[model samples]
Target: MAELFARDTLSSQRWRRRLVPNQSFTLGRSTQKYPVVWDKQISSQHAQLNWNGVQLEIRKIEEAANPIFFGSRPRISFMLDPGQHFVIGHTEFLLENSEPTMPLPHRSPRTEVTIRPEEIRRTSFRKTPGRIELLTELVSKMTASTDHDQLITIALQQLLHGIPHATDVQLLEQSLDGDTKTFSPIAWDSRDGVSTPGGSSQSLIENATTSHMCVLHVWPNEPDPATADFTQIAGHDWAMCIPLEIKLNQVAALYISGKRARLEGNLTEVEILQDDIKFAELVGSTFANLSRNMALERRQSQLNQFFTPGLLDHVSTDIESYLAPREAGLMVLFCDLRGFSAATEDNIDRLIPHLHQTSETLSIITSAILAQQGVIGDFHGDAVMGFWGWPVSASENPLGGIQAAWEIVQTLAGTEFLCSDTPAKAGIGIAAGQAVAGMIGSRDQVKVTAFGPPVNLASRIEGMTKPLGIPLLLDDHAVTQLQSHPSMPPNTFLRLGSFRLSGLRQETQIFTVNSGEIAWLPEFSQALILFEEGDWPQAISILQSLPTQFGPRNLLLQYMQGFQNQCPASWSGTIERNTK
Candidate 1:
């Protein structure tokens, strides 16, 4: 299948007829016929005509537009050059013969096309220096599109006006079993859909092994049923036949046409019609490659640097810092997988995939956190440390952390993996306080990691979750801050009284994660409550105790570290929590 098409396209009949201009093209006062007018005027400026696969240069400017059409005869008359007639096809070129020339269409090496003066009459030529310029302009505009629909829309619009005779513009997509889903490709372009001579609302595209069959017929029977690859349909005095080449059924083709009442001097002339086919093929290839790159970029943009691609792009220091030289409040989160090491003893491969899936699930949750203005700090071999209030300073880092933890628990616990039924569980810890955030790493791996005492405390609390049979625990700072908020979700938060979080002289207050639809919201609102109550010490304590796991915990850890050293030590030690 791959080696089917040869590089020799000089012998095919698909080459467009080249026009030999005798007189310069006559410009008319017709604003409707040609909407675009280039101010730069330099005739016979080494212009090229691209037909099926041939490239022919026009020595003189007998007449030409951006892409003149020969498929239709003019309602009026136009001048033509004699010695070297041009043909439009996959490429554009001049015919050496004084009379009609042989077809130069092809499968490969789609250039060096030829046409006699008698073969071509209608044609539009742009003043582009070369194909590179034409393709560059197309690439710039097509990729600028925001979405898939917008990209298609713009392409459609350009085709309507750019082509010589294209009407009732429509796009078609192929389906399985060599069938087609008609009346689609509603992508926007410069011009909307318009009716044309050969236009039809209904279309059938047969997706085949080697080639595609596009048939458009009237109320009568199908046209040329015997022809599997190439067939023509003429109804209401209009006809169009498309032959497609396919590889692995990845359906793709370009269909462009328009209506014109007056076609003469070379109307339906083999030279002119062939040119249109080649032109369509080239346009299709250029546009397709350009769009694929744009889509790839768009996908990369949506991902978080750490989880999206764990690769490098633009690493900005100022952009990375939440607290460059001052202080800011933050929320810390700690996430650790329970029984993970034991479960993976013999099932390392199984465990890895499960962990990946869990991490992906957590990544989604973290995106939601950042969407609401949050961040993740670090990932610690199955453990996570996160924070907010820097990178995107919001008063909800603590609450956001809690929300992230609860979501992970619910999303994982409910999911049953077909590959392995390892218990999906995570321990989460939340805190609030001052910390520093900015770029801090070697050239090999530069990232925005946080530092401070609050981060360490969060780590201690996370380590204690399994021992206490508690999946989530919020500190004094998070509890007081979240409770004061009226929009906090309705959940039962039990006051686990006072608890020691390793190395801390005083017993830190903690809260546990529970079930409910709105569990995530409270996690976001916790930071606001802590700051409002003016519990600076407790806030710093909770904020510093972030885990080193992969999701929100990492962000919280970063934020808390950035703030810990800068904040005031004044704190209120009341860690009260409520849930329903």
Candidate 2:
């Protein structure tokens, strides 16, 4: 014979097996499917020739371990295209060859017999490269999904369809000693080759038990599990055994006979045994590096979630390292979502996207605030509450707050909601002062919100429109801070004469924003007077009554949602302004 193919020596590890007094070989077979085998006999050194048809690779005939009646040595298997039998070599073994026995109450869900290859969808792997390697790759993708089970079932189905006489497949696994061990793992590969969903899992944790690892029989019987591995699995029939194992975080296993094989190949199976070693230890170590990098990404995301890019710029150390609670003269700005309540009914289909779009709007403002080194507080539902400076900038630029607010108002005013029938609008409120800044709110409500008079004033201005009927408002303190700022849009704001704020004894000189210093002015007082007089229907009608309007129209569109839609038909021209 040609010298056996010399192959690379695999890892040579010390492995010893304890001899048992009951040292006997079992022959197993099943009537439902093919017989699987332990292939530790696999010689990386030599390639085996395909034999027993396309179903098996032929090994040496003497090594087949054929069954004998006398019973002098270990054991042998038999071909049971009919009864897939397993013959055991033990003292006082059965004297006669018997038919494979069926399990009691055999109407079990897992016992459905699957015989045809087409019964399940399995294509013979004809691709170049390793057959086992292909099996490994496909098997690697399986999870607890039913698709995984279907894959294996399809393979068995195809095998049965081609060799209609074949039945009784067996199962095997690697033992703690890293040796092959076969057993009567349960399965039905005949009627619905898709019977027992053998291996698949959603969690890597569950993979511990369901991974396919190895098989037992090396040769095929006349298309039957019974005679397939009679020597390996005896006295059982009509079932399949699967051995599961995980290697390198990937899993693989084997399948075999079930409750049908009688004398020889009844339940004989192929096995792959690995010692009780921590496979995950090697796996975890490999994943540890990946875990660290993933951890960094998670940390980065967490930080980005809280800080605006502009705010992130000055924050030099890790996010956990510092906190600043005071600012010299930072401006405080609040951007309120106007006409927000009606969105619940008006744009029911747009709830999520609206929220997201709203967040993006707030994000744009936050981004601008961050650009100018401003800090952001928590968003209270429909309103964004935050102060500029501190934590991000130690000293506040009251002008920075005004500029940020002005830019915010301008951005939203000019920008239309892509989803809106009309452009979306918001209210901008600006206030500036020396204020405290530290974490506020009780433990239960602990939020990175701000404190101090400027914050309250900004928040109050955000809602001032309901009373003063303005899209944008600035407290006198804010105006003073921005009086010299270079970026302030040149706009002639209509001054609303001083009025005593509720808490303060003195009047706070406030102003309603009219137009950008560079743009055409609007009739701010008239609109304010109508809205304040509770003539909202006419208030919206008057604005809806404009031609090629100014930037502030966005707020009116929102405010109009709050007013009744019983206005006169003359407004339809502008209403089509949005519908168009």
Candidate 3:
């Protein structure tokens, strides 16, 4: 008898039929005469297979146009040998000759073959490039590959190549909540060398939780009286489910199946089961480690968004110690876009893109600050805060804050923001003093920030820029600190006189940077001095005579004019701010 195993073209299913000697059989779409009937693609009289006393031959009929492939290559027709395989129109057939044997008058049943656990281990370990070698290779590959999909595919291919009888393999991952599950098709190699999706007979998670191996025999057409209650849901004739322990209290399953169930040597079905389970465990462990490393990388990426690169490295080493509260002398910078609120209101439809561009502009400012070894603070609405000289001292370069602020102003002025109709501009404020920096709030909701008079004062100074009509401003402390540094820019700081802010009792001497192209520093300095000395009339005359475009805006000139009109005997040069 010649056994013809026909695999379905569409579903990758296999069926068995026996061919008798000197009998002819037709294979086509007509179900009446042909034992194998595929769909419309197969012609009514597609091909004929004839079994002579010794050999089987296949011939294409008159209606068939497509040629059949013998073995792995295409051919018109060929005689089938004991193990010859051929494919016709997506369906493949394997020929195996089983010689008839006469039975004795009273024959005893054949005994089942079984092997000891140690014997199974010896057979598996005897293979070339043994289990240990295979696992080491798998570990190296998993460690080198960062992509999850690629790693899974490589592991599956290697497993199939190692096991000759395992036809299909799939990986089942348990969902985090343990309520749902998903499976990834790793690799499938059938007799035709075609890949097929693996099927399951039971819930993979349920089987995996048992933490054991199980083998089942599937009968497609007949119900087995021995195991009548359990339906064989797998596509293949036999399947083995092996649970892989990935971690403590966590398990994943590897499903292996094949169309034939035959043992070679001491490699019985149970021994093959043991070998597959061991291999699955190794692959699962490698996957577990890779998953942990990938998770750490993701967390580090999120932290990079909040901290500078230098701070991030230190934080990763010891996060709790780095976040501890401490008092330190530092320079703080506050910056806000000039017309951000108005821009957002004007282009409501494009708000998201507008905000993305705003974020990019802020990123540039952040990079400038980080270049000077500064740490980014909180971002509130359109404003961003940055600081230096804490977590580590930067007192050796006290001018770092001012230089960073200057660069931020220059960069924002030079770069064009995307999706904006008008040019974007920013106002920055700098202050250097003692501050308390640390992580605040409860464990569930905490953030790192700096607090004290300097932090509050920096915010106030940034607000003064709008009224001053300048792009950058700083308190007297920042100016004094920069002046003490030897590398301070010549004539960059200009005295803007004293002002009593709304919250503070004492007056703060505010200053502005000489960033504009026009040279009004000399005239502005002289006018500031005269105004301080109670020479309001002369100061107002000098301020009025200066070019409007090159001089201060109407705010300062109006104040001087008001002072000139009503001069009190006890009057001082101090300006008071009633509102923030």
TM-score of each: 0.36, 0.38, 0.53
Of candidate 3, the 10-residue stretch with the lowest lDDT total is: 100-109
Ranking by lDDT: 3, 1, 2
Model 2 Cα lDDT, one tens digit per residue, 172-257: 22333347322222222433321222321112111223432211112223334433333224433333222233232222233333
lDDT of 1 at 364: 56
Candidate 1 off by > 4 Å: 1-326, 349-373, 396-398, 412-424, 488-492, 513-580
lDDT of each residue in 120-182, candidate 3, tens digit only: 345544234466777787778667665554455556655665565667666654444366544
What is the Cα-based lDDT of residue 264 in candidate 2? 26
Candidate lDDT values, in order? 0.43, 0.42, 0.64
Model 1, span 1-580: residue lDDT tens: 0000001124321111222333222222122111112222322232332222222222223454433323342112222332233222222222332221111111111112232222322444322234344445556766664444434444454444444455433444444344733332322121222122233223222321123433222122233345411212322222223433222223444444333324445454333434543344445544555556555565345336432231223324333242243356777776777666775675776876877866775575566445444556777766767676665554524356656666665665442211113434776677777877555567686555567766776787766565444556778877777776677765546544355555666667766544444433343335425543655446445544433221233333343355563443543433221210
Candidate scoring better on TM-score of 1 and 3: 3
